[model samples]
Each structure stands twice: as C-alpha cells, then as structure tokens.
Target chain A: MNNPLLSIQSQYWAVRDYLSPEFVAAGDFLTFKFPVWQWEKGDPSRARDFLPHDKQYLITRNVPCLRRATAVNYTDADEDAEKLLSFLDEAEEVAGPDGKPRGDDDWVATHIGRGQLPYLRITPLPTQPLANLNIKDTADEQIDEIPDMDEIPDMDDEAVGLEEEDDAVRIVHPSAAEVNSTAGQNLLQVRTYDCLISYDKHYQTPRFWLYGYDEPLADSAEQNPLTPAQVFQDVPADYAFKTMTMEAFPHSGQQLASVHPCKHASVMKKFIDRMEAAQPTEGEAAPLTSGSKKGKWGIGGMVRKVTGGSAPPADKKEKEPSGDGEGSSGVQVDFYLVIFLKFIASIVPTIEVDSTTATAL
Target chain B: MAPLQFQPLSSQPTPSFWSALNSLKLDKLKLDDSEQPMEAWLEESREIHDREKGGTIGVSGSVGLGSGAFGQESGERPPAGSVELKGVFKNYNTIEEFKATETKKEIFNSVADSILASFETNAPQLDTFLLVTFADLKKYIYHYWFAFPAVVSKPAWEIEEGGLVAAEDQLVAEARKLADDLSNRSGALLVRGPAGQRTAAPVKDATAFFEGVPSSERIVAFHDPSHLPDAPGWPVRNVLFYLASKHGLSDVTILCLRSGSSSRIGRVSLPGPLSAEKPTFVGWERNKIGKLGSRVADLGPMMDPARLADQAV
Candidate 1:
C-alpha cells in the first residue's frame, strides 16, 4: 500500500481506506479510534457521475467549536524566531534549495486570527426528552416524529438569536449553571460544525465541505439550515473572500461553503517533503506535530543517513517499513488527509474540526 | 402585562431548493410560467432565555423546503412530513414578469382567497403559501420572494390579565402524542378541565368540548414557533380569527404549544370576532435589513465552469 508508483488520486484513496497499523488511538483523548477519515460514495441519486464511485467524499462529524472565531485570543507562533530559523537552516543544508518553503506555510495558521458562528435563536425546548437522546439521532428523529411549528416572527432579537456578526452576543446553554437550576430550560447552545471532507474531482485534491448545525439543528427540535452568508462568516476573512465558494453539496445539493482545492496539493507537498527528509528515530519519537522545534534535536545529523527519496515526489522511493510501529518511521502517503486536515485547521482555526492527532506523520 | 405581539416566519429556501427549481425548469417546466405545487413547512421556537427578556417576539417558523427538498430522501429516514403546507411556486419567465405590480398583487389575492375558504369550512388548513421567483438558470442566480399572507384582524387581539403559564405535563404529553399523526399535526386542539382531570381533543370538537365546559376550562393548543414568552406562533392568530368568525366566540384561552415538549396556556380574548369578509392580509417577510425587496442567490462562483477552471492544479 506504500507503493511510490500510485498516482496522487489513488494515494489519497489509499490513505482513507487503510486501517493504519501504527495508529493506536484507542486511549488518546485527542483522536478518534482509528480509520479517522471514512470514505463515502455520496448520493446514489446524483444525476451525473463526475467523480469516482468510492472516493466521492470523506467525513468526520460533531466537531466542537467552543468560542467564536472573533473571540480567539492568539499568541503569535512567530515568537520563537531563533529556534524556527535554525530548524530551517538545517533543512536548507540537508534538502538543498527546496527546504526553505517547508517551515513557512505549515505553521503560519497557528499564528492566524480566526472565528465561528451559524444562525441561532432560542425557543424553549421541552426539558425531559433531550437527556437520553443521542445528539445526532435527536436531530433526525424530530424530523420524522415532531410536528411542524406555526409561523412565529423573530421579535426578541437580543434574548434569542445569534447575531450574524456581533461580538457582544455570547453563547448560553441550559446546562450552564443558571439555566440548570430551572431544569426544563434550553440546552448548552454550543456551535458545532459537521466538517465534511469531499473530493472535488475538478481540483483532483481532497476538497473541504462543511455544514454547521445550531443547537436546535443538533437537537432535532428546529430547522435553521445555515445560509451561504452564515457559512462564509464562520471561516477566516482572508479565506472567506478569496478561497471560499458556496457550492452545492454533491449528495444533498444543499449549498455549503467549501475551501477551494486549487492550492491544497502544493501546501500538502511541504509537510510530505519535510517528513521524508528526516530519518526514522530508533529510541524516542519526536513530536513532529509541534509547530516549534522541540523534537527536531538530531535531524541535521540524521539527514545523511541516505533517506531513500524525498516525498511529494516526481522521483519515487522504495523504502522498507520500520514496522515496530509508533510512527518511528516518518511519513507514509497514507497519512495525507491527517496532514491535509492539519493544514485546514490552520486557516479555519476557529473550528475544532479534527481530532486525528496529526502526529501520524 | 404587555400586549401580545405575533412573530412572523421567514422563508429560508436553500441553495438546493434553488438548484431544484433550476432543474424543475430545465427538465419539467421549460416555458411554462404557471404555478407549480410545492410543500413548505414551519419549525418550532425552542426557548425563552431569562436574561434577554423579549417583551414579545415573532418566531420565524417556516423552513420552506421547496423544489429541491422533494426528491432527495436520506437513507436513515422516510420522506419527511415536516410541516407539510401547500406552497404555490410561480417562476416568472423574466424579471419584468416578477416586477409587474399586477402579478404580485394577484399572487397575494390568491393566498387571501384561500384564507377565506378555510374560514368558510372551519377546517384545519395551513393553505397560506405564495412564492414568486425568476431563476437566471444560465448564470445560476435566483431571484425569489415568499409571501405568508396573515390576515390582519380588524381589531388586533390582545392578551388577558396574567401572562402565559406552563400547561400541565399530562396535557402537553397528550397533545404531543396526537400531533405525531400528520392529520392531527396541522390542526389545533382543545384541552378541557384542570391539570390531571383535563381532556385533550381536536379543534374540530371545540363545539362539543365547549358545550358543557366553561370558557376558563376550554383551552386551545397549537404548535408554536416563538420562544419569546410573550408571543405565540402566527398560525394561532388565524385560528383565533376562525373561531371568532364561525362560532361567534371572541374570548378564549390559547395554549401556545412550543415544540411538542411543553405548553404555555394563556387567555387571548378577541372582541367583535371577525366575519368572513374579503380578508385583508399583512405578511410580506422583510429582507435581511427589514426591507421589502427580493433576495438574489448567485451560485455563479460554484456553477460557472470559467471559475472552476480558474485555478488548475
């Protein structure tokens, strides 16, 4: 499965399908069990068959977004300038000319400003039923079981409803202390986005599609399908204006905001190259997941170990697996989407979308 | 206490809804600009937060699942019966067709006529729906508007002393269970008697339910979409009009049913119950800024081949 001969499209599919032997995410709170990215065939009712059957999309749901993107308090990752420069200087001496760009794009998102919100309005929910119901099931069940509501105007703008762009509007939940005292109050109105990773055949890289369900949408008591304008506001301003486009969901045809895939491959190539250049560690594994240089202590000396071939390759490598597992051997093309999502989390840093623990590299 | 204010439901037609309209035009109704039938429904309001007390509010209840909502059904669930109300879709052949003052007036009149018909039968009907659009198919941009014609009562109704109070759990549970049936789902109910001794029956039985019971015990319950404690969803307002016009009853109790989980019963006494006259209506959903203009959804960025081809990997 680690064959260097497969095309990038096949490689992306391989990563999604493979049950990684090294990925023992069982007890890890930061990650899902295994096979983090599940493959989907999308809607069978699709009139056109433009994309391949199995690789149509990839999804990971119920990602929690705790605070508004505007509320994010970020400390610049550029703070440790000296440590970052030396790591790049080492890559420059080892990988020759191409190493300079590797450190720049992969870590810049950690320093970026980001925020999130989908439309919300409070209408008192029945207190009892929501307790035993699974969040996902409750949403689907109410569509079938519950009756439709009468048209009520949105009058109390302040007491209920999330402002599409106001910072003064804070999130409140029934489970939160004050409301909890009154039992049958509203549930925690947490804004959670159902992050969907779809493969856009046109761009040929893994494309991203996201649908945000409000607490009511999540609870199945209301139908506030997010608008295209609301979806744009959830993403960073830079990406929203430039790279973001409101595209129809390939399966449901509901319009959702998707991150344009034209430049995804180029940025992904940086991490792959960085992984292939550094040698397999024998004793303790370094946390390459760091945006900083904490685990890169011996990489310069390990660089000359005749690492087979640099990844993101026009040139191929036939390196054998150092199968003791624990990612002692760096970078399998199988870890692409994990790394892809890491890059995505950078720009749209507000959505806590991934739990894949990008340490798979 | 303050007088009650009615919240209006704004029609949120998804991009899929627009895409479906685009397809319906291309494959099915090419040149025909006549009305096409659609099923649109409303959503319930879920809460009344204490800190931000709305003196009264209008809950935007309708989630108009238009043409796009028809065909694609999910694997886990059957076709949804979600607030299945009749929606009349009139796609104007051109923007001029949409802009014609007479055309908009005629659409409004058609909805008004339906409200009159519902009042005549005293039947449970959510027949009030009107949608007009001009879809620029080639460009993938859509211009559309939805009109929920709520008949303006001659003398707007007022709330009685003592604001809405939570109905007993037993009645709420009974009303909720009956609501699961699609037939019962659209109609209002009459809950008679005190908490444990109450009997919940459809509004069709209001004549019998109120026969022996006092006006104090005969309470009306309908699905509400407003969470503001002061307001009930808009459908009940028409029900109020219907009861006034048909039964000659002006004073009654309204159990503002929020979702199916709970109920807030209050007395909304209307004086000089409305008679079936050519009903005057007042429901044109305000736009994002509370304006009376149509909204345009441009999917050109995603649909235009030129844009997709802009960046070649």
Candidate 2:
C-alpha cells in the first residue's frame, strides 16, 4: 500500500494482493548482510533482528514477481478482512541514547538491528528498476530519488525515512572491514526460488508456485522447470544427514519428489508435549534452557534462529538419525515429512509416497 | 491513495522459519522424529480393531469381497448376525463408465437420487449434507473446512503419518469432557472403525455401536475409497442408514469425503446421502471458502499474480 507508482486491483476473489511487496522472480540475485557480530561476540541482545531491514526495498523494486504492486490500504480491509494493516500499526516508541526525540541518523544506527551498517549498502546494487515497467505514465519519472533528511521523521515504525536511502543504491562503508574484504566474493549464500505466477483460467484465480533452488535456472530452461530431485541435488551435501527424500510411488507424468528437513511444527509439538508430560498439571513455562535439545531446537531457540536469521552451529549439529545413516534406502519417514510430502502431492496430484525409501519414523 | 508512510529501510533479511532452516548448514541441525507417536496410534487402532472384533473379523473380505458377499455372505456368517461394515466405497476404473457413452453426471445424478431416497425413507430429518472429495480436492476442501465446524473424514494416510490422530484424539478428549459436563446435549464423537474392515462382525456393527452410545450422538467413520467398488454399498448411504435406524435421531446429516471413481489422484467424488450438489460443495469459490484454518493460513501467503508482477520499486 505504500508505493503509489502503480496499483493492481485483483479481479479474482481468491487473491486480493501480494503477500509482501518484495516478491521476486526465480533468478533475481538478492544480497543481504549476515552480521558476524552475533556469531563472534555471542551477544544475546544483538542476536535478535540480525538480518538487515533494508533487504525488502532491494527485493521489491519491480521484480518479475511484482511488476505493478497493488495499491492497498486499511480501508481495503472491508473488501477482504485480511487487509487490516491500516488499523494494526502497532509501533513502540523508542527514545534515543540522549533520552530525547531521535533523529534519522541516531534511529537508524541505534534502534534498527544493524549496528554500524548504512541503509544504502544493505543489498547489492540494483542495476535497474523492474517493478513498474508496465505503467508507462509512471515509468517516465524517476521514483528512486532520495528524499531530503528533514522531510522524513526518525520513527521506528515506518519502512522508509528521509535520512537513509535505498539499501542497494548506497555505497559500502569504508571502515567496514568484513564487507570490504568480501567485496568481489559472494558474502551471502543466495537462494533463488523459481516462482511460477499464473492465473487459473478455470477457477479465475491467481496461483503462486514456488520451487526453491541453490542456483537459479536459465531463462531458456523455463519449459523444463527444475524438479524437486534437481533442486535437492544442489542442497548442501552435509544436509543429507537430516534430509528426508520423497518420490512418486506410482509412475505418473506430473510427479514431484522433494527433500525437506524436519518441519518446525513437528519439533515444537514434541517440545510442548515433553513440557506438558513433565509437569502434568502446572501452568508454568517449560524449562527449555537446560537440555542440549531444548537449547538448540526449543521454541525460544527456534524463534531466535528464525527471527535472527542465524544457522545452527556446526559443532552442535543435531544428533544423526539412528537409522542406516543418510544413504539408507529404507529410512524412517516422520509425520512432518509425510505432511511435507502431502503438500508436494497436493501441488502435483499424481505424486505418490516413495514407500521403498520411506517408513514410519 | 492513502498517505504512503514508508519506513526507512534497515539492513535485515525477511524473517522466515523454513527459509532459515533451508539456509542453515546441515551439520548441527537435529531432525526430531515426530512420526513415532502417530505410528504408535495406528498400531493402537489396529490392536483395538482386533480386540473388539474378537478375531480378525472378515479377514478374507479385507482384501476384496465379490458381489454375492453383500447379501449371501451376511446370511451364511455365524449366528452373531454380523453385517458387512459397508462403510467404504472402493475405487473402480471409471474408464469403462466414461467410455460407455454414458455421462458421469447422469450416473452421479442417479446415485444422488438413490441416496436422497434412502435418506427420505429412513431419516428425513437429516437435511444438511456436505460431500467433499479426497486427493485433488485438498485445496478446495481445506479452504472451506476452516470456516465450518463439520465432520471431516480423516483419511488413512492422515491418520497413519500426518499427526491427525493426535489432533482428533485431543478433539475426542475435549468432547468427552463436554459430554460429561452437559450430559444430555453433547455433540457427536467421530470414531474410527477400521482401515480395511469389510464386515460388521459382532463388535462394531452400526446397531450394537449406537445402542451402547448415549442419546443424541453420532460417530463419524472414514474409509479409503480406493479399495471400494462403485456399487450399492456406497460409504455415505451406509452411514446414513447406520446412524438413523440405530439411533433414530433428528440430525441425520452426513458428510462424505472420498476419492474419485478411479484411483488416479486428480478426480474427486463427494457422494452425498441427502443432497450432493449443494451450493457449498461443487465449485472452487475462494470468497466462500477463503476462511482457511489457522495452521493452513500460517503455511504461507497466496499473492495475486498481478501484484507479483508489479514492477514498482
């Protein structure tokens, strides 16, 4: 709803708007900084919101996934109950270090998770704007002009302000040794998700299909999309330790086989259940800080890992499965894997459970 | 347009749990085995089925039963007066049916009429009916199931490995508490019969099962239609009579979620007992069915295609 360069109102009742304005196409390379401060210093407070906030601007700028973004507001909630963002602007006011109203510079450096990083240099430079290409009227005007610092307020709530500029357009800081060192190399491990956006002619609705890959497929390979098998091939070889591979049972043309690691739902369920079992009647919080399992995969740990955008440490990797190792043909299939497989099957109806390689976990 | 108040961009990546998992290195990540509990539940269900029947009831019929078994086999069985469970309607190769110059619509219409007739004769009060399909109907059914508190058929796959039993078990426990608290007016409890039970036997037959239950109650029984034949013993019709003659309750409504005429995945058939072609059943209308479940909505977002294509930076 923020961008007014173009507006897309959905005729299909199923989908009213985009999930995030930042929907990108398959091959679009997005580079966001993963701060080494949390890893090196192990600062618990700094652990939260480690990922840069400016990544959204770099990703949402006229990518193929969102060519002409929808013009939505809180009032749009009347049409569909989901567009309630207008009323839910729950922003907490954070005072500056000086205990007074903060300026854009102080707010960006202190409040927003990134400590010393500038907003402009968050992601790699954008060569071109691809979002509003279809809007001929707006295409004539340059929309990326940096607003004056005084024109914007230093509030923590809004996505953009006058002080800082587009993340991709800004230059890297001279003093940031880590970023400067990795100038030529890929600092962030980029994962390109091949998204197929199409309108279901029969249902008169839009469909958003996503296939994750370690590498992007070539444009010529559009006809032959990467199968789950092909995608899993690119997954880190070490991941095979926790990977559960699925295949189509019966030979069907429209078949998909995926290799998804343990689902968070499954892990969280066990954690809660264990907690409840230990204290049958007590309404106390689960003691998640003690055990190795609880420390790594507990609800709090997972929230930190997910929200902080950090990976599990290599030294304390999850205990390997008790089965015949990663290459075992008759591997036990867990409930989460089945749900994941079912989701794959739902996408490709002909897909069947590869019973030969899977069993009850 | 509303006054656009874009926040200053920060240097953080979008927060996604699965994406984080996907990005994390494979080394230290632990994969908890969540399927063990559900597998145990399946084994437990099989055990209960075995114990209740006193033996492997209708072991021969479990694989398949011929046309004669519907009538003749029931009479020849032991003096226990057992009937065929008659809950599941196995999948038949609909190629012949489709190629016979006969419209499936017409066949479905006839079947619908027959089901409605059975309902009228037995339990006319069961007016509200819902027929949902399995397999390809997942997206469609899930969209609506979020809104309505209707009986959902727990497929064998879901029960065995998808942690559905735990959810249903919780539902049963909650229902039991409510039933005890308000003794007279409690909702029905959905119970599983057996995965492949073809005979009523003495144990879980419709009559005996209902006679034991308190008044004003119903139990939802689900079966995989892949193993069933497209014949007289349709799953929906059988449940209608089973609940009606056994309990003689006013709420005779039946909702059936089954596979298609053929075992091939995309095809789905919602065999209705009273009325199959309700406004809610046939179409894949998103406005009507967009009330997604909490878990499902949390699964991911469904963005509009135009919005995805929007080029605005």
Candidate 3:
C-alpha cells in the first residue's frame, strides 16, 4: 500500500498470465500488413481516408487486446501497426466453432477488454471548441462587433500534449481517487469498469458483463447521466425531502385521544341539552307515535298491557254496575220527568185540566 | 109811346127793328151752345160761344133749346144754322156779356197760383218740374191734402182740466186700443209715430219698439228754446223735426245738391225718450266733390214691428 507501483504490476501480471494461452494462439494469426496509408505522418492526403465503411470494417475485425506498455507507443505510427497486428492474433484464438474468424465477438475480446487491453482510451473531446466555433482568431480579437465571450468564458485547456513514452504502463488498478472522480462525472464510465470483462471466446474486445448497458442506440443522446446521492442536497429543500424516506410519525396517540374527548363530549352535551330543552312541560303528554310502537307506545307498555287484558276479562262476564242503583234510578226518573213535562206542557193547554193540579196553581 | 109795343108791319120793310130783334135771339142761342160738336158748323159756333162765355159756360134756358131736346145728349153742341134765327139773335148778346165776366177762368187762375206758392215753400226744389193734373180741386184735396188729419191734436174728450195733454198719453191710449184691436183680430200692432210718444201699448203681448224713420221727407225737431236761425233755411228745420219725431233721432245735418251750389238740403235728427240719447251722423268725412252732402243715401227698409218685437222678447 505504501507504493501503488507493485500493486499495479501485480494486476498486470494477473491479466497477462490469465490471457497467455489465448494471446499465444492470437499471435499465430498475426500478420505485419501496413495500413493502406499512414495518417500519423500528418500527410492527411496520403492516408487511407477511413470513410464510414472502413470504420465499420475495423470495428468488426476482432482485433486483440495488447499489453499497451510493451507492444505499442500510442503516438508512434510503427507501434500502432504492431499493436493492431497483435490484436488480430488474439482475435484468431477466440474464433467461433465455425472457425473462419469470430467477427465482432473476437474483435471485442482482444482489443477492447476492460483490464487486458490498453491500446486506446476514449476520452471525451472538449465540447467548448464546438460551442465557441464562431469565435474567430483565437478568441482574442477586439473587433467592434465581436461578441463578449467573457460572459461565457471557455474553460477547456489550450494544449493537452499526449506523448508516447516507453515507461508508461496502462495500469488496470487505478487509484481510488481517480476512479471516484471519473465515475462521479458519469455513471456509465463507472458501470463500464464494474461490469465489462474479456472472454476467451471473444478475447479481442470487452463485452458488457450486465446486459443493462446494452440500451437502444436511439435513446443514447436523450439519456441523462446517473448522479450520486450527494447531488440531491443542491436541489430546493422542499423537493429534496420529497424524494427522501419518512423518518417517524408526527403525532402521538395520547394527543389524538385528548382532542377527541373534549370535542366529542361537548358535542354530546349540546345534543342532550337540545333534547331536554325541546321536551314538553308536565301535564302535556308527548304526541302519539302514529307509525309504529317504538318510543311513546313502548314507554307505556304496562298500562297498555293491563288495559288490554282487563278489557277482555270484563267483556266475558256480566259485571256489577259501578255506581249506586239509587243514583242510577234518580237519573232515569229525571230523564223521564223531562220528557213527561215536555209532553204534558204540550198537551195541557188543550186538555182542560183542573187548575189546582197544574203548575201555575 | 107808353112802353113802345111796336106792331109787326107786314107791308112796310122795317130792317132796323128787325136787326135788333135778331141780335137778341142770337145771344140767347149762344148761351145754350157751349161744347164743341162733331160737325164742323156746330164746332165753329161752339168755339165762338166758348170764347164769349168766360171760356166755360153752363147751358141754360128752355130745356128744348138748351140741347135737352135730344133724349140721349152728346157732348157735341147744335149746329149754328139749326138754331132758330130769333134764338140766335137773342143768345148772341148774352154770349158776349158772359165772356166779358170770365168768372170760372178767374177762379181757377187764383187756385193754381195758391198751389204753386205752397210748393215753393214746402217741397224740395227740383231741376225738372212735375205737374200733377187733377180733374178738380176737390180730388186733390181729398187724396193728398186732407187724407190724414189736418192736425194731430189731442181729442176734446182727452182734455182733463188742462190746456193740452201730453202727446205720449194720447199715443199710449191709441197704442192700447190698437193692441186690443190687434189681439181681437189675431194680429199684431205696428205703431210708427213720434219718439216721445209710446210706440208700444200696455197689452198682454206688448213687446218692443224700434226707433228710425223713412228718409223721403224733411223733418225739423226742436228741443232747444231758441228757434233755429233762418240762414240755415227752413228745409233744414223741417227735416230736423221730421227725423226727430219719426226716427227718434237727434242732431242736425245739411246736404247740398251736387249740380248747383245754391241748391241744398238739410236733415235734423229726431229725439226719442225710449231710444239711445246720442244719435250718430253717418256722412262723408270730407266733401270730395266740394259739396257738403251726406254719404248716407237712404235709410234701409223699416223693420217689421211684430218681427222686431219677437226678437226683443
């Protein structure tokens, strides 16, 4: 841990030994063929002019993954050719059962594997050049109409000199700081390191260990890069918590119960007071319950039952009269006397009765 | 020679005595013949007799000789030759003496002169004269002169311890009698009289009276004590009294003839107690013809009394 060089050397050895058989078999297919033209000499006109068809052919050729420290000088033209031949040798070892050449699978295993190959690193080109394409003459010209680029200053480096040196090794075991920084910039780059591996059957290129990375090509431009949890803190507070898990309930049971007792007890007391105030005074009976025997009739059940039973019993028997016979007889006599008096009065005038017996006497 | 009874000498020719006796007979005959006859000889003799018998003569003498002999007498006289010669001789002298007297001619001349004088004083003078011929003076007297009462004086019976009663009293009596008579006849009374006199009677239907006068005659009514001076002339006074009585109007006005400067007429308004006191003089403001004459030509026709009374009531 004191020196990371040893760990980097060990990581390389492990990758090499593990891939030696496949590498030796890849070497058997190696051929020292020059490119149709050399583009590294700065004679762009004499170069092969890799049109879209040539780029496609190169991608399908199943080139091998080389130990970039030993076989290639990334900036040298001859070294790039030797590394390309080595990639072809490794592609031949992982040829399919049909055995002509493994196509893109062998090309991916030998040259594009995560740990074993270091022929090329695809770093993103600076986007500021394209954004500032309208800035003429090194962006320092002070023409009257020139836009104020200070409002949008360029941050890209002026010169990034990438040189090929013989001691420069492609270390598969990068420092954690480097890994974290690069992975923080884009999740796909981190995910590519974590999930991609070289296969013996397709030793020339790296294949995605997890199929999740094999997204539709059409959606690639519209997708947002994955961000870490720490980035969420920069969003507005209200929205920040909206995505977080709830910690605990905001109210206790005792507090809820206490509120209910006062509210519900007061409501019940008002209901009882309303009912009592609505009741009728003494000597004023409640209205008859007309539809069903529910409240009023149910309350007078004993009186109704006794009256019902006594009425049937009295109906069966010829009961004695309630009042005295003398009083009843007097009432009968009074009734007859009124009728007799009315009749007698009506006939008295025509009867010619003696005056002594008449009421006028 | 005692009263000279000369006998008729049949043997001797006695011409002088015969001529004298013939002259006496002619005078007697002449007196009998006064009118012209149809025949020429009778006409000539009648003219001669007319001249001799004061221009008119009454036939006289024996009935037979005086043209009474004819049963139906004509206006003609007998022929001169038909008269007895002796009758002619006796009437000839009488005719001469009758003509010399001229009694009838002289009486007519006096009457005519009196009439002409009255006209000069009373009537409006005319440029052209008109002569009215009457058969006799009695006819003129009956028709024009004495047709109305000679003087409108109160009746003798109306004198009650007085000199003269008021004209109104007489007028009222007359109007009442008229109204009574009119009522009896089923007609109305129309009294047109002087102004101060009652024009209406106290009858059951006594209505109204209107004041105005007919314009032909000149009248002169006077209320002032002083008589009008003569320079304005008598016609002015006459017309004044007439208009005052007839129309119950007052005020005097004069007009002159357009044809002559000296010739003029005058009018005076009559007064009426029952009429409007102030009377209007309707005449031309200026004498355009340089003569003082009234523009008022004539009063319109008189209003019917009964109709006027009906309107008043």
> lDDT of all predictions, in order shown?
0.50, 0.21, 0.20
RMSD per prediction, one decimal?
18.0, 27.6, 83.8
Minimum summed lDDT over a 10-residue window in model 1 chain B is located at B48-57
Q: Every model's DockQ, to 2 decimals?
A: 0.02, 0.01, 0.00
Model 1 DockQ reads 0.02
Residue A325 in model 1: shift from native, Å? Answer: 27
Alpha carbon lDDT of residue A269, candidate 2? Answer: 38
For each candidate in turn, the interface RMSD (Å) is 14.8, 28.9, 97.4
Name model 2 segments beyond 4 Å from true: A1-300, A303-361, B1-107, B111-204, B216-242, B245-247, B251-313
Model 3 chain B weakest lDDT span, ten residues long: B140-149
Please state the error at residue B151 of candidate 1 in Å.
1.8
Which candidate do you rate higher for lDDT, 2 or 3?
A: 2
Candidate 3: tens digits of C-alpha lDDT, residues B77-160: 221112111111111112123222233223323333432333234331111111111111111110000000011111101101
B111-149 in candidate 1: lDDT tens per residue? 778777876675645446778888777756676767766
- A342-361: candidate 1 lDDT, tens digit per residue: 56776666565543321110
Q: What share of the true interface contacts does candidate 2 keep?
A: 0.00
User: In model 3, where do residues sit more than 4 Å from their true spots?
Assistant: A1-73, A87-361, B1-313
lDDT of 2 by residue, A45-105 (tens): 2221322222111111000110000111111213221211111111011111122222211
| Model 3, docking class | incorrect
lDDT of 1 at A329: 32
Number of backbone clashes in candidate 1: 23
